[model samples]
Target: MTTPAQTPRSQDLDRIESELIAFLEGRTRASWDEDVDLFATGGLSSMFAMELVVHLEQTYGVSIRGGDLKLDNFRTVRTMADLVRKLTADKDTDG
Candidate 1:
């Protein structure tokens, strides 16, 4: 369970999403469209993908593992936001 201090608000989610989008935009030469497929379009590589997971875990204070680390969860910025929300909610409930 998370203490009140550790809980992430909706703004935090938005911030994380913005940071991720900015990071992806800067790292890859391709222009980022929020609806574009990051992997299919060659915007993100396997190495960058792992880096994203690490960033999410650190920034959101959430642990992602097993099925949670699948490509579907990491496919898009919106999906990433949803994954973080689910993980954060699960942690808070468990805590």
Candidate 2:
């Protein structure tokens, strides 16, 4: 179940997905699906992952740390979107 506030979060997630795809496409000739394993599929590397975290933090204004930096969170495009949604929601709730 999702609330009204989560609707905007969902939109943001979609936007992030598109942006990530664009970024990936610019980096490689490979195409990625939403469920593709970013790391295992070689779509992402540790160094690029750190860059991604920085980008997400700057773009979304969400501070990801501690438990948030797990492999599961960065596994796929969909999972990354979910992580962003969670972080964004946490930030909103805290403020």
Candidate 3:
């Protein structure tokens, strides 16, 4: 099942969201939506964001660095998906 408005970017975000939810659920032993704030609920920490950065890099093949290291980017699954999309787009343009 798909929507008529599902662009490639949307599809990518969907995949990212599903994978992120699975990973977070496995780590926290709980389930959440893409918009849920993982940190606000006390289920995650700034330290855990590093592990997330590594996971994003390894899973998406995108190198996160500099300004992109901000904790806000990893606060929610939606934000993380957006970050991956941005990094992936940057990679596409750079190479």
TM-score leader: 3
Writing each residue's lDDT as its tens digit, candidate 3 over 12-81 gives 9999999999998999898888888888988688777789899999999999999998878888999999
Whole-model Cα lDDT of every candidate shown, in order: 0.82, 0.85, 0.91
lDDT of 1 by residue, 1-95 (tens): 87565445667667767877887778775566556778887878899999989988998899999999999898888788879888988998997
Flag regions of model 2 displaced more than 4 Å. Answer: 1-9
Off by over 4 Å in 1: 1-13
Candidate 3 weakest ten by summed lDDT: 41-50
Per-residue CA lDDT of model 2 for 1-95, tens digit only, reads 97566576667878888887777777766888888998998889999899888987888788999999998998888898888888888888998
Displacement of residue 14 (Cα, Å) in model 2 is 1.7
Worst 10 residues of 1 by lDDT: 3-12
User: What is the C-alpha local distance difference test score of candidate 2?
Assistant: 0.85
Error of 2 at 93 (Å): 0.9
TM-score of 1: 0.77
| Whole-model lDDT, model 3 | 0.91
| Position 83, candidate 1: lDDT | 90
Clashes of each: 1, 0, 0
